[model samples]
Target chain A: MNEFLEQFLVEARELVEQATADLLALEREPDDRASLDGSFRAFHTLKGGAGIVDFAAMAHAMHAAEDVLSTVRKGDRPVTPDMIGECLTCLDQVVQWLDAIEDSGELPGEADAEADLLAARFAARAAASEGAKANSPVLGTAPSSATALAVLQEQIALLAVRGEGLEGRIASAGRLAANIFRHLGRFDDAERIAGSVSESLAGLDTTSIARSIESALERLADKLSPSQIAPVAVRPDPLSRTLRINAERVEALVSLTGELTVANNAIGHIAMLAQEGDNPLAAGIADEHRKLDRLIAGLQRAVLELRVLPMRGVFQRFSRLVREMSESLTKPVRLTIEGEDTHADKAIIEMLSDPLLHVVRNAMDHGVETCAERASAGKPAIATIHLRARREGEHVVVEVEDDGRGIDPNRIRKTVVERNLAAADAVAGMSDEALVDLIFMPGLSTATDVTDLSGRGVGMDAVRASVERLGGRVQLETRLGSGSTVRFLLPFSVMMTEVMTVEAGGQLFGIPLDAVVETVRIPREEIRSVGHAHAFVLRNRTIPLLGLGQTLGWAKVESDSDATVVVASTGGLLGGLEVDKLGSRMDVMLKPLEGILSGIPEIAGTTVLGDGGVLLVLDVKELLR
Target chain B: MALTILVVDDSKLARMAVAKVLGGLCPDWTRVEAANADEALAAMHEKTPDLAVLDFNMPGRDGLDVAAQIRGLRPSMPMAVISANHQKEIVDRAHALGAVFLSKPLTEPALRDFLAGAVRQIEAGAA
Candidate 1:
């Protein structure tokens, strides 16, 4: 796309989002003038953006919405649910058109029909409100100048009062008169008012200030006609200090940084080889390698920082969704988002959108009860779904919690048995906690009838899969009658993985350092065999042991007099993996297994080693399972 | 002779918009841009400009506050205070500081009028 169109798309999308938020806020608080003005300005700017892009249809639609908003701003029409809905619908159409333009890099050819339909709907709403306004004797009939004059007169009366704060009142009245005159384009009258007010203030003469303001008010009443004092046209706020960089460009930079890290690793390896030789230059080469490593690390950190973005972009869309769902389901729902400014990798944020959609849809469809049902059950009629994101150590934790009907373990248990996902006797013995976990099993939905919204028997499982694909885990916590919170614990960033390379049975493997607790060596006599598996004791705790070579189906080599074990922890379980040697730690960009290697339970992914060899990174949880 | 104009706004986009308009109106006029009150004050200290345009709504000190300080330094300097918020208080403050109030998004004709008035003020002060 040309730069101008691209800029327009970015700006127009932001305006749409802003307008949607403001309209929703207005729906919640009809008297919120800030939201009213914000919506008006957003639509006005959106229309400007459309005009710049030469998209007349979008401009026409936006102009209609702006006109209705203008009426609301003027207090001629009160904000109604129907009006907010129409404005939201208009925004929805604009979003669709924006999507089309982004995809095709040009204005959509067939947008006129949709725009015309939306514009007509908005115009009808405006006209209907105007008709009602016309019938009312108190509204839309008084001239705005009369209101300004009334305000000035009130100020004059206050100034005339000989109160303790009389001086303050005089100053305020003087300011009011000056503003009134300036707004009327009578600059000289405004200057005269200002001059008199300042001179009076210097002399502490409140009467003179009031007299000057009264005369200015009289002049304004005579000269300022109704047509002269037009309503102030709301404009956009100051632009934020942000740059719109293409996501692909950042991804490309990440890839290049990863390549540089690999190259630096190769240099370190060469330095090691040189150190092994008896040459004077070996020390110099090693020094250069250390310097290069530091530079590469800084570069990697900067590149990763570039990919970090706040969670607001993903969280802001849920407000509109909840509103629409509340309307359709006949349930009053409120969505509260917290910690949306928590930063996470852009890739993680993008991948979270679909899974979050599924979870939120499920929350609305199956979790929240109808308003009538809620009121009868001694709960508030309005259901609140709280979407929160926060940084916890090296993880970005997202939670979608709803105050509604919690997931019933009994329902899940029955569904599990009916779906044949688990044996009846086994499910009967399972605890309620375990039974609730069965919801994550595919095709184990408890809803009797499938709804178009969420209960398609494919939501929770997909949510788990998507989160796990990012090396994250999904957890659910619920009470029988309270509510359910679906928590996703995800890695802060997926671009790089830090692993400790270990030599096992003459072959090398990579273990994610996050799971590495501690390594120890124990005498062969101290190890015991139990049920054909070896076990060992470390720090007075018994940890099961697995030979990496045997697990990979390679020929097992006899251990030396002492066994070297790498202790790894995953999913609250600790296991010692027997290795021949512990290698150095390094950062690598993990590539997901492709083709036949994909879906391997024990192997998580592969990374390129300094020797140009592939290192299989283990999924410690799956490996121990 | 060409004259230099100082434009101060917290938003880079707002500064660019003002600069673009000024460039079109007075191609020979040099423009100096500042993002905040401190930068604007510093620019004035370095070299005073013939005309100034300041955004009323900024981060630290508002445009009128800065205008008041400029008025202390050069009492007769012609200035315009620009803001999207057309509140009466802001306009009154701008007028008290001897600056014209211009609503945003600023139009070509409105800016042209302000510049013409400013030029006449500078000429009158020189005479």
Candidate 2:
């Protein structure tokens, strides 16, 4: 039961995210059946998950939304901007409930009341949509009598306009009056009305007949109901739409696969030992072990693939925040998302959410100017903020760029000095790049005045912290007049990484393969030293080399005539770490350093090599800095 | 052998909820779980459950469709459709299929009632 609750919470949050995204997407293409189905499915899943956990109030609230979505799916109601807003509100309520549940393992005291209020609102909206129902529209409990009377009124109007088609028009009008009277249980009145119309027809008097029909129509109008009864479209798509599984299960699968890969590597080592003896049976075992290694590697890859998820959910959320922020700031800003289909580890994407949101919000609030200000600056009234994510080798680079007033480095420098963030003389000598980096320093804001939109002092500092937590770094680029772009380069997955094992000082250290450009042998004869920093020329570019043994606090080892350098780069900072040996490359699932070593700058994580040796994966960027 | 019950819902949580009630009411009963209609039908194929609890609003096939399939083969099987939908149409359909329509959240009282109904049906079937 506990496991189920845990799983439910995970699935519920995902569905809420999905539903919110689909509703916002529907704002773009209201006629999109796919989004409609997607929304309905999400609500359905949310309600179902809630039900399983016996969270009746939450389930009931989602049911109301699901019903509204059902009506939209069946075309009984048109998808309006208001409806989308309502759906988003409903999702917001779900988010609140999920948060409360996560905190207390149960709902808040007012959950039922809140659920009822939201359900009532959704139901009221559903009823309003029914008012605009296409067929058999009724004014209010307005009986079939009202419909007949409406028809009679139309017929009489036609006759009055044509002035000559009175015979057919009067005959149809008389028939409607009779049926309405009969429906009202007034048989005598029906006959009397019919007789009066016929008598007027005999006198060939159109005016008299039309007058009687009008009086009868008035009587029927009093009984009208204020709604229409329209048939819902039958969407009989009986197929398995989607399946939600516990993410923990997938995580477990990945862990097992990692273990198998290590085990397989050990098997290879054993097989090599057997083949060294040159016995026929041992060689056969070695050949079979080779085939097993390939299979295990494939299985490992397949398992890890389960953790990859598209960035659509995370990216879609920004548009909503952008919309709300722009309206509140009265800034006419537009957001464009590119490469939303790019995929990354679910954990990486999760950690990226708030940081991404902060960047986007900061872009709209600070980077983009108001219409009046933009117009004066000769820029378009509506500013554009573009968010793009694309795979770059083993990393996913997400950039939020805006066409607003760029961050002024001069102001940042001034603020740095005024706020005493740094010594005045030191800040004055700082480069523009270094000054810009000061914005991310917590407790400081470059904004001159505090506004609700931003300027809360918690600026890029939080974003940088989050990105760094995910084994990623933040890059900021700004021009004085043009705009500012904040880019985050993160690994494809934070859970597992491929590292190149290198031996230094008789200890093994792993370097993320993505950060290593190449390994080269630079002769010591060409090495130069400037103020205790080692430098060497490699392919026309001067690269600095730091021996791993020297960096890790071991006795400084002097390089021989030819030295091995593992060239590494992070966030554009490059350096070479000379190690004694470069070992075999393998995949290792990482656990963040804990206990006393949690915040160690040099050690990113620790992993066990196949031979039971613990290897510390070096934080290449940190080491270079 | 203990009577087997198949619980189908898109939510693992909801499936667990029903399993809890079933476990409480019929301690000896076996409970099989499926996350969607396809798995539900697949479970039915393996071994017909004496009782089936389904949730509506799945992606592909919903509760009603799954119920209809079961109605064809196990016409006397006592089933309950647990959904968040409170529409009259859903209740009517459940009645037509001789199944009980239970609103979602599937709270303690609701599940207890469902169990009672299932237990009665199970005894009648055995007789």
Candidate 3:
């Protein structure tokens, strides 16, 4: 691929994004002049770009859409939803073309047929609008033809200026006349004028060329009716101060930084070993280790910052999705986005799209009420779904809130019992919040009938699982009659995690330190059997206990002494794990389990320890569940 | 002597396209590029070029607007106003400003003819 094509791909994608944003904005506010003109210019410039690359099919398609927008700009037609839809459809095709070009390093071979269909759609919409204005004087020809004739007359007048560059000026006038004729679809006249201009240019005779253009204008004036010419509006181009870098390169840098931090930790381990031996250089080695640790910490932070991206890109996509969903379901729902500028790690943002899509879809499908239902319930006819994001402490919290019928705790309780997920007596004794949380249980769905958008029994649990895999948590709050909001609390970055290593089944495993409340030594006799489970009293509160060796299916060693226990909290529930021993704490970069091991929910990921051993990190939430 | 030609377009791709063609046609001539009218005018003020190729549709001020200003400074400089949009208003304005109107995507044949005419005019004026 040439440099021009590469640049074109990048720029064309940006233009498509900008144009889609503008069209969506126009859909909300039809009379917004800035958005209308912005959409027009984006399309105009996009068409020009296609022309530059000799992509005639794309240029032709864009020209059709641009003409419709030009009519709206001229006040001949109002900005209708149908018009916006057609233009958006055109942009979608452009996006597909851009992707194809990027993949193949050239224009797609099959674009012509797609472009034709898109152009036909725009042309049909334009013709329908033109039919409505049948009474107008300019019937067959567009108003631009009149402007072309006026320009032809202007070119003739310009011939009167006999000056230093007269020869070039005359050649330019001839080319302009021929082009205008061609633009009006008068091919024969365009050719004749072009031929005559070439002849006149060879002789340097201004009078003959002027006569030829005047005669052509006279003939054209009879066919083109006069129309008002609108002045072209000017808008300032936005300047970009940021540079575009390849995403893979950034990922590679992040991986290298992770390895460097691990190497630095190894140095710290060596320094500790030196101190243990009482070596003469122990103090100096420890001091140097501390300095390396601080510098690596800064480098880690700077590298992580490169991957931070604003949530706007992810949030903006929901607008179009919600719009299409609203139309398809025949429901009037408006998606209001807030705090889109909140930043998150790029990996988190990329993984967020699917989960967010499911959440928003569920909110609209099951949470928001229909217009009729809302009207009878004394609520507004149009329901609103708020997609919000914000930074809260060490986490970025993304929330999807709806203003409609909230999730009924009774329905969830019934579904839990029907699905046999929990005992009926236990569910009955649970609070409304606890009952609602049961919606995250797999195979439990309150909706009686499944819809295409959601309610296939694989939603909230998957959402929770995905969030947990990213070292995050999901929370749901519902107000029975009002609405529901699902909040995802995600870490600001996912690379580095502080973990406390524990000896379980004679092997070392790392448990995320954030979940560890405290470590204790408790007599084995204090653990009371609670029907297939075990519980122990800690500070007057009964906490469930699990033997790590037994849970991991390892050979248990018979011991009568006090058991070493690590108390941890996951999903707001406290639990104690009996391990063989508890080790020191260290920050390690986690790599998610891939291939066959990925199916195990209890193990979140693995990290390389300083001694080059793999430390398996436990997912406390998944384990407790 | 090699001459300097000013190329102005808001779209970097369009500017590059023209530069690519011009590079092939006139390798000895120096090409100066500007992204918008401000930069184009600034370049003109810094050093008047022997020729200019301007895009008709740009942000802030279109190409013809810049051409008119350039005409005020150097009336006899050969210029071509290029645009994908072939509206009569732009063509007439280009003609009124004594500029050759070239439609885009600018073809080699069309640009080559304009450059040939420009070189002849420049050499004639020098003589």
Candidate 4:
């Protein structure tokens, strides 16, 4: 099951308990920095881990507790009974969710309520203790006004505290303002403000005179980008346990692995050439080739292993969403994620996120029954949604399943006919399974009414189309009373793309392996022209064809007696691209279009060939769109 | 009825400007002006406002004297001390008395930020 979650729960339990004890100790001895730091680290760790596992409510509660302890650490607010109580409550809430996660691979249903209650309490305590002296704002990170704002605020509070050098500082502050205005060519206003400051120095009390100086200084600092204001370092370390690495670094590793594989192939080619020479070095070359080949293979595997991430990251994000959806709909729901340790390529895991989220959304919004309905149907009052992932040979299957009232096949049949999605006779001949599967059809939602969660009718079909675009397949399964499961079958890794090379418009282009249905050489005369586009019959259906040179904005040249067409499909749409010829299919590590070229969607990504030239991969989905 | 904010500064011009600002931006807020600690304390007892803003250095009994006395009277009253002397210990003392602080000649943005924060505290106290 979720072994990773099991480890997280065990460590989290200890951290939560440790934090609870530290908070109690801090209550007894408010100035105990050791205990304060202990609690801060514990909650911070707990919050980070909880976020990783998708225990949102727990993460949220820990976050608030962390904030409270931060104030204590900063010496801004002394440990109060209310703060201690709030911290303990926050700890208790996280522990409760941890227990639920341990027992079931899901958080408890009341998590949101607990988070809200604890957040409100923390906010109330923070509000009550208003000396909210945060780190003198990070001037370097903030706008120019931030430093001025901090200085202005500090000086305002300092007015009454001034004993010595009060007049000199005020005079200097006035002169600073006058100097600024003088440089800006507002000499009259400058003189007026400066004269007022010098005169007010004796006319008003110390507080009022200081106020006048503060106003003049504020006007000076307003336009001046003088980075003179100093900010105090008010942190106990926001990062301690974790080391964050850049994404570019990880991608560079992947790119190097690609080059390593290419170099390894060159060694094999040399070994073959040596064998033909019939020399003593031939045997050595062959032996070295075998050893190098194995080493390169292992190196490539290790590199790919770095990019493989378990499902926990994506699955953890869903629990909070389910909690939010349940709270929003006033429907109690539980989310269970299994096989969280089942690792997939990081890119593949991220690409699978949107489709899986939509499926989970649909499961909670429409698949689950209300408490009253569930009670009447002799089921648990709290609806359950199970998110399962497992490796099935070549593909990893992720399923979002919910046991509630399932889709009615008869309703689908009716909607199919009503929406003109299918002919009346065609729908009449469909079986229950086939009819239920029609929910995957675009613009054919079975929900009686639209709600915030679902029933937009664009939900399931979009999931299907995206999954298909990622070279994966989405399937729907249901029984009338047994609920439904939306399953997405994805590849093990998306780091390396298997693309079929095609020569188009005298330049080379790469078509993703999944997008290519077949490359057929059709007779030139058989290509019929229809509305400025060529077409040809495939089976009984007419498929539209376009010249690759024309599509790429190159001048169209007259074709030969025969044409080589690349059959491409994106979701349900089918099309043909007539190219000069097809080349050898190769595996490539694609770096998606970045920088200025990133927004241009037609070119999906680029990859390096053995000779180091870049090959552009075509995104058929955007191409058709 | 409009909420009230007491503003105590020794200078008449300073107090009048604050009153004008209260009337302009926060029209509903009634400004209870005071020239010193005694007047501020007297104004507070007569009709306590939702918030208190006092100048730190006043004649006779200073602003901190007024805050200390007010804390003794209404321990949890939302109070602020405006000063130009940014001595760490002095600001710390004001903070120790459970009073927030502001710089002199409060600008519009700073005033707005402080009010938003203080209002939350007031609402939380009420809750």
Candidate 5:
């Protein structure tokens, strides 16, 4: 993933968690002010986030939810449990779609059904409210010069509650409203309110309201004039959201990253050839290499960072998620989230939305204890789920922890044994930690009954696998009586890494810096070919030598050159990449090739050299498989 | 009345899509198609259109050149330019040439809304 996308994944995961918890809480207490405020804030924050990240679909949906919340907050309407339920369902769909987008660049086919249902419900609610107001004027009708005095009185009364700073402006609005009423020949009512209008207007903040009243009076006077034979049409305001950028600019960035690599390699070669003795020329070359390396690294970082987007883009769906999930589960779990300003690769964030939701739902349905249970357990009646994120060295660590009935190891152990995953005898020898780890095993579940939330069978293993695929690791740690914490450690960015240069099938390839554990040059006599797979016993460990050419469907040939075996680790498994040469570590941008060219399993992407030659960056994780 | 319209484009798909949307919205309009500025001018002499929707970029004569020429010939004629890319430079140029700007890929609602606004402005100005 790119920097923007990577940051987005980390941030989006947190937002999803918050949204789910809030939704669950809102279900329990629909009229709770804090719950309502939090749900609205989550939606608003998610909408703003989605807008910046160009997640238009999520932004559009969140915007609709925001409209509902804004209307509710303005005291114009009430949020019902059913409405919250629908919103949470929408959230689930969006989360699933987001996950789909993360794993695959597009949403799955079923996302449209959820979007349509939510949109229709949103539209129906808006329409119903609009129809009610249209049928009943209630305390207010559309403001006109004839009703301006009443409008002024209402404003003055409202503003008076807030105190005196805006009194002067409010008084002016009252006067303007009276004038408009007089112009419209409603002088009888106008004259009655004219006495107190000035004092009332003075006690309000009516700058814009006063101006609008004045404009209305002017228009009314014009309309009443006998000389006005034809109606004059007012022009419409210009509104647009379109921009243009040069296509060449993006291509230029790609070329610059390539040039940096060439210059970097040349500097290294010059430094290596310097005199044996400590000389000024030799030191100068070394110094130049260091400076050039930093310069290139900075340039690469700057270019890659362009793709970084804030996590808020994906978080917007969470607000609706919270609204939906809270009602569905018949539980109240208020989500408190922070650190949304975190940025990451847009692609990574887009993919992160779903996995985050699964984790959240899993927490709410299975992790967080019920309100009565929590109170009986000497904890607060409501569960508090916290999601916190921050950068650690070259990776971003995102943790989702809830204060609830912690993971029950015995429950998981029984489930695993009943499912025939492990022998009953073996369960005794296994530690509590080992028993708890079973929750993440594929097709494992501890829920006694299957419901809409959790218990349907898919568990934490899917999330763990997806996180690992993004060059990250997922670890689960829980206290038996406390709560469970799932921490994901992912690289800050994926485009640029310190890769070890290796030659395979006589072609140069790069192994990711994190994947390579060690590189050893073993004598050819020690290498033995076993059933088409090359194996070498390094020290005591038997490692299989994965042929880069044979595995990738490239032309295979026998070579006389000494082999350099690079040991790499992928998904807790060790493998070796046998190559003819081992070059020094070099930094290069990972550029995914166009279309089907990138479909090659062994190749992660392609990078360009200063000389314009393409270097295939090998996917060490994929290669090991 | 059969309202005459000038359609400018370089991309075949974009032109077809825009035409289809226009046809769907205002089926009475008579469309005059042009691949570039040179073709647009040749078609312009054959008949003067009531309105023109020009594409900003093309190999021979870009949308801006054609819009400028239309402005010189008939300043009051309703003219709008469609652009795919979002660049202030091109938008400013279109504005300077006295044309409404619409960015693609043009959905049905977007196209209809732009046309409605443009038509109202044109008819209001004429009145």
Candidate 6:
């Protein structure tokens, strides 16, 4: 699931609750915009959320409910008790759909009935309104729809205006005929439009035009029966239509071939190295070694790239979600999606969606606000959520930022202490930003009760765990009452590893580059002691330093004032690690720990370097804890 | 005329990749690489290429800065931005600065399309 969907789950659940409440309230007083807006938001958000999870059935159902509410919102049709009942029932069905989705990752079969009924109600109301308004459109608020329809009607008229023979007329009339054909349930006409639209939009924004076509198809679905609605081949797996074979895979395969060539050369070199002859094998060994080195280097490059996938795959789903949430919450939000082409590995991308969702939801539910509240604060009622991705050095950083209520670090401190999750003294000394991070701790929630949207203690921890398992870090930044942003620093891919070879205890241990911050030579004079614990002054701050020998229960070396230190940090905690020597960075594939060795909390994974030597990758986060 | 192109990116590797792709496609065209927009601007002041390919996100004065400056300095100079950040604001700004916008991880297809478009625009302007 993407960030929008996860956030939508929380928002949808909340929307369902709100929708139910709004429905009950509307039963008594139907004109309240708050209730109507709330109900609309719930359905709209539910539709968007369902779309993200690929729960098309639920999305379709919610779309129907949204259409009805949207029409009512425009006052094109009055919000009758029957409409309210049906809308509320739709909400219940959506809730049930969400439940089913959660249970099975799919909406129930035969679920489209409710959506069809609701859509029929909307279409019937629209027809009745059309009958009543012979002079003007009854839905008088939005001119956009009217303008578009006028365009359609004009095109239909022009087809009659221009009879035949002129090639221009044939093309223009063809388009109009196709538009009328698609909307008027003429399969042949719709196909013509599809063909022309595909051709015309060839050099234009293909995605947007396709999306518009998709919307047109959706709107047409209400008028036609199920069989007629799916006119033309529905283009089986339309997703695959746009999907290109991931270039990273091709790049990786190329690099692997390069590596295999090097490995073969290395085998020849090893054979020559074994038969150490003064004049016989030395030249052959040198030549083979050079080839082996070249091939290995090429292989490493390919493997690293295999982890790099375009960021677009992870960023695409949020747009529909933001659209839904903005409408439902009655907070106009435009998603500013950036870095769609920023690639990261598939595993990291998959792991990323959950955390991003939680953060975005947190921003929407608790961070952003009602229109009235926003107006009072002199902020736009329609908030802006920036979903951005970038490659910062070796890490893929994803940020979900909203222009709503910034998180109150003070509130976090209070929540932490009140919940008894941490000591008051610890939180008191901690910066407000650090206090905010307490949200990621297990069983830590500031919300009093589990609302549909927030106060569910599952979000931050799940995000943190998922990101960490993918060899990444998550950070939360918020301004007091302004808005908040949660960023995940993820590896390019989960499969490839970047390890820094370090000498510790006379053995070469490969520490994952993700864990190592910087290798610095700690001078003897700068090292001090805070009682029995060793400390070092870095940038005028006393940071606790640990020797790998002592931290990992290995025997300590004899006194040496100057120590080679690996400065490392994870999820925020920073410390210096003493090691013998810093080695070169190498790409290695991680092999999982087995048996009792797996129980070692400080070891992340083990990998084999090009030299066919096994090196243990340390888990810096575990050591910091 | 074979178009002379300049590629600007903060990352040497990324710059090399674009150069490699361009070199493979239009080997006759002269391609120069710059690390930052400022350097690119300075390089252009010396000898402006037929077109400049810029990276949008950079440490100092980004692609937008280079684009706006280039547009101001030489109105007819064709420029294209290969951006990791495909924000609408950036795209709008690029268009406003008379620069063509291309999203990053610049594959052969995207680059080919962009180059073709740039060549046409430049040729049209010249005409």
True contacts kept of 3: 0.56
* Per-model TM against the reference: 0.58, 0.59, 0.69, 0.47, 0.47, 0.49
Candidate 3 ranges beyond 4 A from true positions: A1-241, A529-533, A571-574, A594-602, B1-5, B23-30, B35-51, B56-78, B84-99, B118-127
Which lDDT tens digits does candidate 3 get at residues A316-414? 667657766765666767677787768899889879988899899998888888777888999976677888899997799999998878989998888
The predicted structure with the larger lDDT, 5 or 6, is 6
Would you list the rank order by lDDT, best first? 3, 1, 2, 4, 6, 5
Ten residues in a row with the worst lDDT in model 6 chain A?
Answer: A229-238
- Top-lDDT structure, candidate number: 3
Q: Residue A491 in candidate 1 has what lDDT?
A: 88
**Tens-digit per-residue lDDT, B1-127, candidate 6:** 6877888876554565677679888989988788887789888877678888988766558788988888888888878886643669889988888888887656788888878887888899889
Kindly provide the TM-score of model 2 when superposed on the true structure, using C-alpha atoms.
0.59
Q: Give the lDDT of residue A65 in candidate 5.
A: 78
DockQ of 1: 0.09
TM-score of chain B of each: 0.97, 0.90, 0.96, 0.90, 0.88, 0.91
DockQ of each: 0.09, 0.48, 0.47, 0.01, 0.02, 0.01
Cα lDDT tens digits for candidate 2, A419-514:
888898998888888888888888888776678766677968889878977878899999876799999999887766779999998888999987
Q: Per-residue CA lDDT of candidate 6, range A283-398, in tens?
A: 77677676766766666556656545555545655654554454444455556777766778766765677677777777777777666778899986457678888888767888
Per candidate, native contacts kept equal 0.00, 0.89, 0.56, 0.00, 0.00, 0.00
Q: Candidate 4: deviation at residue A64, Å?
A: 21
Q: Show the lowest summed lDDT stretch of 10 residues, model 3 chain A.
A: A227-236
lDDT of 6 at A176: 44
lDDT of model 5 at residue A460?
86
- Considering just the first chain, candidate 5 attains a TM-score of 0.54
Score chain B of candidate 4 by TM-score. Answer: 0.90
- Give the alpha carbon lDDT tens digit for every residue of A197-257 in model 1: 8887887777777777778766655443211322211121222425767768998999999
Using TM-score as the measure, the top candidate is 3
Docking class of 3: acceptable
